[model samples]
Target chain A: MSELAIQTKDISMSYGDHVALDQLTLNIEYGEVFGFLGHNGAGKTTTVNILTTLLKPTHGKAWVCGFDVVSDSLNARRQIGYVPENVHLYEAMTAQENLRFLGQLSGVEDLQKTIDETLELLDCKDLANRRVGTFSKGQRQRIGLAQAILHRPKVLFLDEPASGLDPMGMKMLRDLIVKLNAELKMTIFMNTHLIGEVAKTCTSIGVLNQGKLVHKDTLKNVMDRFGDDETLERLYLSLNTQKVA
Target chain B: MFASRYIMTAALRANLRDQTVLLIAGLFIVLVLISAYLGWSATATVQDVYLKVVEAYAAKGQIAPPNPVPDTPPLGLLRNMATYVALIGALAGLVLGNKTVSGDRKSGVYALLASRPITSSGIALGKILAIIIAITGLLGVAALTNVITFMILPNFSLSADEWFRLAQFYIASDLYVISFGLLGAFFAITSRSEAKSLMIPVTIWLTVTFIIPQLTANVLPMAALNPLKAMAPAPSGAFFVFTQSVLTPISFAEAYRALAATLLDFAPPGFKFQSFISPMLTLMIVNGLLISAVVVAFGKMDASRSAYDD
Candidate 1:
């Protein structure tokens, strides 16, 4: 097994003439809450897609938990779970029903028990029997999180996890992210434009602008060098501006 | 295989909850029942009129002509079922097929499914299997209705040979509708817009069910309702010959109706034994080809880009 939780080598993805992700290289250690900051269409989701084995990079390679995202995609997928921006599910089904379906697809053994434990772990056991369509955005996100981690994946990918959430919802998600990373020892890769959430939750941060990574460092080093969320925000803006220029 | 099993179960549950699909399928089964009732009633009505004429001949102390109702095949009463299956049953299958894929895409669950340890082909196969099972269930109801009607209604009992023919008719019907379902799923996977996903297959269904038959067999639109109606031979000409040669091979509606007419024992005189066998072959081949196309289209689909095209 690889020491790194996730690794990529000059992965490039293009749709026709437009490149969604350029030749980019990256790596993250196990158990790190790595925040990927990028403006809309900066290829954050695209990167997550590649890492989750939902996509194959046009040129180059990626590995998740030592498994190639392309050639060994099924094994790579077995290691990771992903929640997209909005986190839609079968609305007519209950939260538990949706979770069970996805968990079975993941080939989780002891499925019923795992579903119960995962729901309890996410602190949303009350929502399990309720229909997903009837739940609020916050409630749905909790179910989504439960579904993603049902198989106990080694890595979890979140794309705009905090989007459309109220403050309390955001806090709950942050707490869950922390719990999964700290207690479960799972590598967490988050894609978001919210630097505030990154500052609060991510241990390491990388800034991507137009498919290019401009800055990457540990949160402590970035905080000591750049000083606080306000200064870090400025640095983020400046990096994007420079990349655009 | 495990992933596909669960996927199929989930899809079946989701489809059952979809009101639109339920309504369409329910309507189809209802139509089949109604067609059977009407067939029984028509037989009774003709029998009543013939009895009245026979009594008048007996009162005059004259000979009565033979009863015409005996010539009508017991299964022929349900001939409207062929048309119903061709039109409404195919639509139900199409809608079910569309929902099978579009539901995942619209709900944004395609990414989740795709990211799982299952291959896209597995996902496609699971969904296709679900369609096959659902269509079979629908046609099974229609077939049962025919059997029950035959048992209850007088002058409608079938011999063992006819019973086997009825079963074959439904199996062929199931395949015909399933072909449309696969067509719908193929378009749903390949097309971006939900409307296009549904519309393209419907257009093809219309072309196959109506236009092609007219061009090749010179079948009038109404004549198609009576699967046993003898096609009026078109004027012998180059255009007619050319169309018959080109379109006949692809005319599944004609194939299906020919097969149904033969099975129901209502075929026109001089219906060849070869015609009976060829339609079934055509249906099986078309289904095989459609299944292959659908699996290939799904395997090539980009999962990351699979989102609702509103």
Candidate 2:
């Protein structure tokens, strides 16, 4: 009964002669952890980039929080927080400074408190004063998350948030994502290749292959379609092979 | 309000943290010191040479040396130092501005910043302001050193008026350099590589500052002619008639005629249209045009495009 947080109608994008997104239509409801699965060049980043207003869509339209992504970009940008794949920070600045800088840019009032709360929420309060260049991969990931959620965005777009994290780090990030969705009532749109992570955390899922959405359903629905005998990993492999053939 | 302030603070901090910035500032200080010492030594040598020449002329009784053989330094040394300072300032601006605009793209910071709510114009403005502040600080230190050198030199009384005039010239020169620097930054943002951006500014600076000045001074004979000549009254009497008969406009014969007319009590020339305001106004207009072009180019820059690729 909740309204859709994101809606796209036959969206397509191309770069030069190459098609990046092929008439992909999708709808994600409010407060759902929507996992977007794709291979290396499966238009995942491209879709996110268009949704986040970093790139203009070549065709069709996308609506984020009831505002068109292209025509109402300022509203869409104000409504969503994006964490790019690479956790690049101002290496010269400390974690706290980076959070504060991003928080202000996101129009978060009481910037110092927001930075502190975000850092504390990520359990990075102790590392707040440390320069990002000195932090480990997991620490940088945590800081990146802190920056993304600093403004308490209605929807969070995370691109491979746990890409290079250790097992423990991955668990920690997964727990944080679940907590953010449940406690904050935020919609999560994540792009990743970690089927295990997606299976464990996602409430709804969409699989992209060769610039097209091949599968999309709730976790239970996807599991039912594949049956109990087949694992999600097996289903993914079989689907990818089908695409290749 | 707070967001803009935060962005500016971050930009200033980033610029200050850059090792290349520190290196450039250190290099500037070293160059200023070297220039000061060389200028001082050269001025002393010129005074010594003048003293020797005067003493030799007096010894030969060829001409009586003027009172006390005044040890006035040749004005050229001071003027040359000012010119060097301006040149170095331009070079510093080119390097710093190029890095400020293109370095972010090269380092992957541009994409990150662009995805945020920060506009391209805001980023460009913050960067340009930071560079201007840094360059102004460096120029201030150089000017202070120049003033101190003049004060310390023996028998070199640099009056307040002269100091003001020198400062005015330096400020004008700095303005010109900053304008070119902004142009360089714009080019760097648009160019495929930092080297191309840097080369364009340096080439333009060299052509305008060195080549143009040389050509204006030496090659253009019409530029040298006084505009007040048409306003001067015709000469009278036998002296003028005789000079007019002997002289022609094409040769130094005209110069001899003028001297003879002036020596034989011809009236002084009338008021001329010559004024420093015209050249100064032209320079200001040129600076405005360059700065506006740079700003417009910066405003149109697309952050998503790769700065390293054409």
Candidate 3:
């Protein structure tokens, strides 16, 4: 297997004249929780979409766990799980039902047992039998997390996972992400604008400005260098300002 | 294959829970039952009246007119079923097919599906299989209802040949209904707006069901609903001849009616069908094209932008 869980080379995506992702290259090692920080329309979702094999980049190449996303999408998909910004499962189905379908698609051998174990691990076992339409955003997020980790994919992609969560919800999600990474050894790529959540959850951080990567480093290293005089938010802003100039 | 099966199951479960789909299917089944009951009631009433007239003629020592009731084929009693299937059943199919794709698209589940190990073709196959199963199940219920109605009605026994003909009638109806389902699904995959996806196929359905028949077959608006009248020879005119030549091959609704009427053994007096192959072939071709269109649309669809515009 390739050492990198995710890799991209000069990957650019253009929609007509507007470039969603410019000639950007990135790499993330296996088992690292990488936070991708970008403002709205900074091509964060586009990047996650490309890595997850939901959309192919217009130019350049990407791979997930040694499989090219475009040429070997199925194999690449087999190694990854994704939860979009707004997780929309079949509303009429119960939480377990939704998980069962997605798990089966992932080729889970002992599906029922896996579902039970995953739900218990997420601490939302009580939400299993209830219809997803009735759940709040936080409850749905738990179920969404359950689906992504059901197959124990080597890499998990979360696009704006903290967008609609309350403080407790955010904490629960952060804890779950950390648990999944530490326990399952899964590589996580999370895209968000919330620097605070990044401080709490992500081990490494990359800042994207105007579809360009402005800064990339481990959280500890970044904090060591820029933490004393300026907050991470100010540091993030300064990086974007420099990129804009 | 396994992924397709899972998708099929998920789609079926979601469709079953959908109120709009449920209502349309329920209405269709109920119409089938009612059609059977009404056909039986009409046949019984006509027979009773005919018997009474025969008795009066016997008392007067004059021969009664030949029995008109026996001249009607046993299967002909359910001829109205063809119209119901053509209209209401087709509508049911459209809704079912639309919901299969649009539901996922609208709910943003397509993103999740696209990220799975399954290919787009697998997803399409699963959804198409679901439509096939659902439409077949509905038609099966209608067929069983017809059989039960025959068993309960007095003097309405079906022969082996009649039973086979009844089955043939439904098979033809199935093809006609499934085509509409595929058309709806085709639009759902290609059209950006959900309303356009549904409305476009509905407009096509309306055109084929009513307008095309009137132009090409010289069938009146209401006569289009009756299988026997729908097959009457078109009136002689250059315009009619041109339309008939141009539209007949593509007029699946007319073909279905003619094909269904033949199976049910309904025909106007002294009007002989030149051949059954023409109508049968038309339906087969039309269905084949629609299926291909659906497969192609699904294969080429961009999953990232599949969500509706409106």
Clashes of each: 0, 0, 0
> Any runs in candidate 3 off by more than 4 Å, and if so which?
B50-67, B269-277
| Interface RMSD, model 2, angstroms | 1.9
Clashes of 3: 0
Which regions in candidate 1 have their CA more than 4 angstroms from the true location?
A227-230, A241-245, B48-65, B228-230, B272-277
Q: B126-160 in candidate 3: lDDT tens per residue?
A: 99899988899999999999999889776778899
Ten-residue stretch with the least lDDT total in model 2 chain B: B248-257
Q: Residues A1-245, candidate 2, lDDT per residue (tens digit)?
A: 22789999899989999999999899999989999988999999888988887777789899899888878776787788888787778787898888877777778889888887877778879999999889998998888888888889899999988898899999999999999999888899999989999999999988899888888889998899889999989888776656422
Candidate 2 lDDT, B147-233, residue by residue in tens: 777776655676666566556655655665566567677778777776787788778766654443222231122211221232243
DockQ of 1: 0.89
Candidate 2 CA-lDDT value: 0.70
CA lDDT, candidate 2, residue A204: 92
How well does candidate 2 match the true structure in TM-score terms?
0.78
For residues A1-245, could you state the per-residue lDDT of candidate 3 as single tens digits?
A: 99999999999999999999998889999989999998899889899988998888999999999999999999999999898899889888899999999999999889999999999999999999999999999999999989998999999999899998999999999999999999999999999999999999899998898889888889999899876877989988887767632
Docking class of 2: acceptable
The TM-score of predicted model 3 comes to: 0.95
Pick the winner on lDDT between candidates 2 and 3: 3
